[model samples]
Target: MRINQPQLIDSTLREGEQTPSVAFTDQDKHKIIQGLCRIGVDEIELGIASPLNTYLPNLVKEAKKITAGSCRLSLWCRCKAEDIAFAATCFPDLLALSIPVSDPHIQERLGKDRDWISKTLTASLQQAWAAGIPAVSVGMEDASRADTDFLVATAKIAQQHGATRIRLADTVGICSPARMTRLVQTMKEAVSLPVAVHCHNDFGMATANSIAALEAGADSLDATVLGLGERAGNCRLEEVIGYLALVLGEQRYHPEFLPELCQLVAESAGRDIAENHPLVGSAIFTCESGLHQHGLTVNPDMYEPYAPERVGGTRRLRFGEKTGARAIQLQLHKAGLRLDEMQIKDLVHRIRSGGQVLNQEQLLRFAAKCC
Candidate 1:
């Protein structure tokens, strides 16, 4: 498939806030927005601006003062006149109005039908346009579950009402890569405006689906720092960006700032960065397996895809239960020690059983013991 350079729309401030017990202070917002700009993301979705939170107004005002055009800032709100009016007051670079498009959501959630959904979307778009909003987009909530024909119709309504873009949300994370690609291709054919994909990780496919969507002509994709959001959270910014850079040869984003960005988000969100999380995780670049470590000692590229420094991380050779004799010998050499094969074999045996790696001081004691 032909690769498309898709724009990343980070929703760390919007959907990310929906994570349980997570709220960003004004300072948190500034740090995250600044980091996103530093990493060169195309846009950032600020939190919903409707219902007028006590802090949101002040947050938006502060964001305007601090952002200074590093990236476009947009606000997300429901498809209602009141929400759009409140969102307009924030004066963001763009406005995104979310509307549910599935039959279940239309009939059960809102007690409305497809016609009502279309009209509500049209009316909301009209109101935003008349209010002189800079740019408007429609977010199709649960688009994966919506009927394909009805989904196209919804996109048409948004396009008719002056939407510059439309987002297809896999609200439940049920779509596969193939399904995501097909959906994006269909939407691209059906609509003239740019199509964006927003995926959830209920089935652990958010990142894969997002990549598939972009490969199939999606113009944009949504991600949150460390994948923070409701339930299993949204697509992870680090994973998607890493894949694009290391595998797909896309370089629109600055991956070097990922470690710092993840740390910032983790601090504010009260979330721990998993040691095994890709890219920014602590142990992603560390090797402990005997065979892998042996191969790594021979050549760093023997097992590594790209350098750890590429993402502002360091490569480490861990000496642990799974470590091999070569790894142990290497560590010993690094500590300025040498031993015969027999002595090294005895030490390796003890290490495998229970011997801990010695520091320089402990190594001196060990050398005296051997003597």
Candidate 2:
């Protein structure tokens, strides 16, 4: 219920859209920004000014017009002068400069040695500072694969040069929670700079890794609404926010709106809400097992975590052929009919024998048949 550890939340509009097929229109992006600010995010990563920058300008222009001015807006970019040049046009509150710290990337992809990358990063940081921006953060493009000593040294250099925060980005999405915690601890011990996490979900551990990082000393996490990003995606905003509330019980922030945000991003990304998706999935709160249904009738807490009402999802009784007496009776009552235990039992037997999946119409028919 109480947490001494402080963590910053950067929301979905920016990093989330990196999902293979997700894109947010200006209106959609603005809506997310408004909600994220209301939800008390410490910072917002408004992913514009990419190599082919367009979203950043649109979001910044629109964001400047909106009134959710509580959180800082940060734009993500590669470690390039032109990207920084693009960022200066809007002069956002926080500018995040991303760089490749791994030797392989520095040698092959970046085509520059560590010395060059470090020098260029320092120059870029100074340029951002001179632009009169409030803060500049550094994001290591692939810290998971980067040499640990090299990563720490680079982070220290960035902090000395002017970066207030250093983000350990899981660029290839390859960090487990344990690795995340260890890396975060290493970074925390290495520099006075605030450490942040930008995890991708290629290995499906973005949220877990992010939580681990925060516990170990990360002050901020980069999350996209509904886990939308390039590979598997960054951590899902709703997932972590819910954990921070329900599991950690900080209660300072309400997490009920997470489902709404998930729907928005899912629509933007052209993905259906997977049935097993946490918290917001249609099946998360629905109970259908015969024995589980019997227990639920007495007290839903037997299996459910927080009540469905807590997250804006409804408690639902899914119809399954393996219906118990209490479950069958409950369904009969829900159907506005009263039936004896025998009638309900017989009905359950009939439904189970046919291997027939019941639809709404069929359920109604079964209810009426009991009449």
lDDT of each: 0.86, 0.78
The residue ranges of model 1 lying beyond 4 angstroms of the native Cα positions read: 330-338, 355-371
User: Residue 219 lDDT in model 1?
Assistant: 92
TM-score to true structure, per model = 0.92, 0.89
Model 1 poorest ten-residue lDDT run: 358-367
Pairs clashing within candidate 1:
none
The sequence of per-residue lDDT tens digits that candidate 2 reaches over residues 1-371 is 23455566565766676556666787787787777765566677777665577556767867766634776777877667777878888768888888899988999986889899879888999888877767888989899999998898899889899898998988888899898989999999999988989888888899989888888878888887777777677787788878888788866556887777777767766889987799889778776677887777778889887888878887766665666567667656766778777777777777777676564356668768666
Q: What's model 1's lDDT at 25?
A: 82
For residues 1-371, write the lDDT of model 1, one tens digit per residue.
Answer: 65766799999999998999998887888899888887878898888877765566667667766777767888888987878888777788889889998999999999988889988888888899888899998999999999999999989989987899999999999999999999999999999899999999999999999999998899999999999999999999989888887777777778889999999999998889989899999989877677887787778899988889989988876554676677767667767788878887776676566656544355445644663
Highest lDDT: give the candidate number.
Answer: 1
> Following a full C-alpha superposition, what root-mean-square deviation does model 2 have from the true structure?
2.9
